[model samples]
Target: MVTYIARRIGAGLAILFVIAALGFVMLSINTDAVVRGILGPQASEEQAAALKADLGLDQSLPVQFIQWLGGVFRGDLGRSWFTNQDVNELIGLRLPISLSIVIVVLLVTLVVAVLLGLGSAYFGGWFDRATQILCILGFAIPGFLLALILVTVFGVYLGWAPVVGFTPITDSLPGWMRSVTLPTIALASHSVGAVAQQVRNAAFGVLNMDYVRTLRSRGIPEWRLVLVNVLRNSTVSGITVLGLQAVGLLGAVVLVDKIFAIPGIGEMTINYTVRGDRPAIMGLILVLTVLVIVINLLVDVFVSVLNPKVRTR
Candidate 1:
């Protein structure tokens, strides 16, 4: 198990390195444009050269990458070209807000999806039909449109939750919940359907497995039989879907964050990209890439735990 986990972590690190390299290359695509962004489009060539030199853009690509990587190792994300503030500080302030929304959305997706899937599988008939309809709608509708609709009904019409802006949880828990509830629903709506379908399919298969049938014949309590034999076996696929949805949620939240007027990493990223703040953009990309890699690694480890044969492989 230790070896398996270590191998997974090593692979995740390698993935993160590749992501960093790709992000750096992409950020460097318009070198002169980046310099112009720093010095303004109207600046003379001399001024651009001066600014570039000052910002170390005059350095070779390999050296620049090494410097950036070293800074990252030391927790220094460099200065933002737009604001001249430390990129790490800027991200630190906003990361929590985004993380909170993402975490809540994940929890909501997992809990609701598992229940819906299990119920749809166990009950069948009308319950399954209704769930199928929901899954179709959830899968078909775009996330942004759903976010807007939710904002209109829940925020404008019902006035149950705030439509725009976010309240930090530290300042007021109730206010935070009220502020975030609609965005959470919007972000999680599709994921719930997607994951629930996976769960339903997996559960259906597990329920009909020979081991489950034998367990049922032995007259074990129905709840235990389902929980131990069915649910446990079904969870591998459910977890795979869940992890994928979680990664998707991270990306989707950028749009959701904008619609809801939240000041988060996504919104920050958009602002930085618009201003051509390469350091900030690179930092954000690397952080998000690491997050994706880490989540996948954890999912792999958890899947292996659920099925020990995976460890041998």
Candidate 2:
């Protein structure tokens, strides 16, 4: 188990390194655009040269990358070129908002998917077919389009939620929840379908196993057979789906935040991108990469705990 964990950690670290290197290289390739973004298009060559020298853009690419990586290791994510504020400070302020929405949506997706999947599998009739149709639609729709449709119907027509803007939970919990509800539903739509489908398939497969039939033939309660054998074993696949969905949820929330005008890491990212804020973009990418790695690690641990074969391996 220790060896397996170590291996996973090592692999994760390697992936982070690759991601960082690629991101850095890609950003570096657009150095002129970054300079223009910071210095403005009217700046002369001499001014650009002086600015580059001051910012260490004059340094070799390898040296700059090393410096940036060192700062990252020391928890200094550098400053944004546009606002000249610390990238860490910017992210620190916005991350919690985005993280909260992502977490809430994840919880919503989990409950909906698991219940729908297991119930549909157990019942296996109209309930199953109806949910399957819903799942197909959920998967077919784009997140942004769904967000707009939700905003149109629930926020505009039904008047159930705020049409746009976010309320911080600290200021007003109920208002915050009300503000987030539509966006959460939109962000989680794809995840709910993806996970539900995986769960249904896994549970259905487990139910067909020889032992499940044997137990059923031996007069075990159907619910017990489904719960103990089908649901329990199905969690391995379910966890896998949940983990993947969680990562995707992060990206989805960014688009949702923009559509809803929420002040979050996603909104921050879009603003930085529009302004060609390289440092902020790099910082955001690093943070996102680390988040993905950490989430995957946790998922691996969870899967290992649930499946002894994984631990043994």
Candidate 3:
């Protein structure tokens, strides 16, 4: 297990380095600065040369990469070019907000999806048909559009909650939850449908296995026969849905955060990208990359646990 985890971590690090190199190259070239130079508005040639030297932009790409990699190893994520602030500090402030929203959305999506999906599987006909329709409808719409629709009906028309801004859960859990509820729902509803689809597939597959027949032949209680052995076999696929749902929740969270006006890393990222704020952009991108890497690593571990043969492999 240790060896397996180490190998995956090493691969993730290598990918991170490649992405970092690309982002650094883009920033070092500073096309905006080049455009400005061509336009001849700000800084003289001598001043520009001095600025390049100070920023180490004149260094060879290899040397710059080495320095950036070294700083990362030492827990120093370099200063932002657009803002003088430290990248780590900025990430520290914003990551919690995004994480909190993700956690809430994940829980709601998981519980609702499992209950509805399992019920649909256990009780066929009308229940199954209704669930299938919901899954189709939810999966059909785009996340951003769904969020806007929800905002219109739930926020604008009903006036149940505030439209935007994240109130810190640390300061007030109830207030924060109220502000976040609609956004979480908008972000996770489609994910629930997706997860339900996977659940239905997994459960149906489990129901056909020889073990299920064996239990049925033994005259096992009908409820226990369906719930215990059947559910266990389906869990691996259900876990696949859970992981996918959580991941889907992340991107949609960005859109949902925008619609609901939540103050999260996604919000910060949008602002930076819009204004071409290099430092903030780099910081947010790296933070997001780290999060993806971490969650994917967790997914691998989960998959292995569900099937021990995977661990041996």
Candidate 4:
């Protein structure tokens, strides 16, 4: 198990290095363009040269990359070209909002999907048909559109939750919950369907196994059989789907953030991209890449725990 974990961590680090190098190279390709975008076309050549030098863009690509990598190791993500604010500070302020929404969304998706999936598979009747229909609709509608509808209904008409702005959890837990509720539902809507389908399929297969029949014949309680035995075996697929969905949620949060006026990494990303801020953009990319790696590693560990064979493999 230790070896397996070490291998996964090593691979994750390799992926992070590759992604960072590629992102830096691509973003660094148009140094002149970035300078012009920041300083305006009316800026003189000397001004551009000065700006480039200040940003360390005058150095060779290899040298600049090495410097940037060293800074990253030392916990410095550099500063935004446009705002001159430290990239680390900017991301730190916004990352919590996005993470809060994502964490809540995952928890909700797990509980709801498990219930829906196991219930549909075990019952195999009207409930199953309803779950199938729900999954189809969930897939059909996009998360952003759902977010808009939620804002309109829950925020505008119902006035049940605030549609715009976020309150830090440090300030008030209830305020934070209210701030994140709609966004969480909007982001989780699609994931719930995907995970539920995976769980349902896995559970259905598990129920047909010989041991399950033996348990049933021995008059083991149906609830216990489904919840304890069937759910346990089916979890591997459900967990895999949920992990993939978590990564996707980061992207979807961009659109949701816009609709809801929540300041998060997604909002910062769009702002930096529009201005062609390479330092901030690269920093965001690196942070996001690390997040994906960490999430996948956790998923791998969870899968190995649930199925010991996976660790051996």
Name the best candidate (by lDDT). 4
lDDT for model 2, please.
0.88
Could you arrange the candidates by TM-score from highest to lowest?
4, 1, 2, 3
Overall lDDT per candidate, in order of appearance: 0.88, 0.88, 0.75, 0.93
Per-residue error at 193 for model 2, in Å? 1.2
Better of 3 and 4 by TM-score: 4
Summarize candidate 2's per-residue lDDT along 1-313 as a digit string, tens digits: 7888899889989999999999888888877777877888999999988888877889999999999999999999999877889999999999889999999988998889988899888899999999899899999999999999999999999999999988999999999999999988888888899989989988888887898889999999987877777888887887798999889887877788889999998898888887777789999998898899888988899899889688666
Which residue runs does candidate 4 get wrong by more than 4 Å?
none
* RMSD, candidate 1, Å: 1.4
Model 4 / residue 40 / CA error / Å: 2.4
Query: Which 10-residue window of candidate 1 scores lowest in summed lDDT?
Result: 226-235
> What lDDT score is found at residue 114 in candidate 2?
86
Better of 2 and 4 by TM-score: 4
Estimate, for each residue in 1-313, the C-alpha lDDT of model 3 and write its tens digit: 8888998899888887778778867766654464344335766777777666766667787897787778778888777655667888878988888889888887887778877777788788999999999889888887788778878887789988776777898889898988888777777768888888777878887777898888889999978976677766666676777777676666666677777777777777776665555556666666677777887788788888767677676
Better of 3 and 4 by lDDT: 4
Deviating ranges (above 4 Å) for candidate 2: 214-222, 311-313
Please give the TM-score that candidate 3 achieves against the real structure.
Answer: 0.89
For candidate 2, the TM-score is 0.94
lDDT (10s digit) by residue, model 1, range 205-266: 88878888888898999889866777888778889888998899888988988999899988
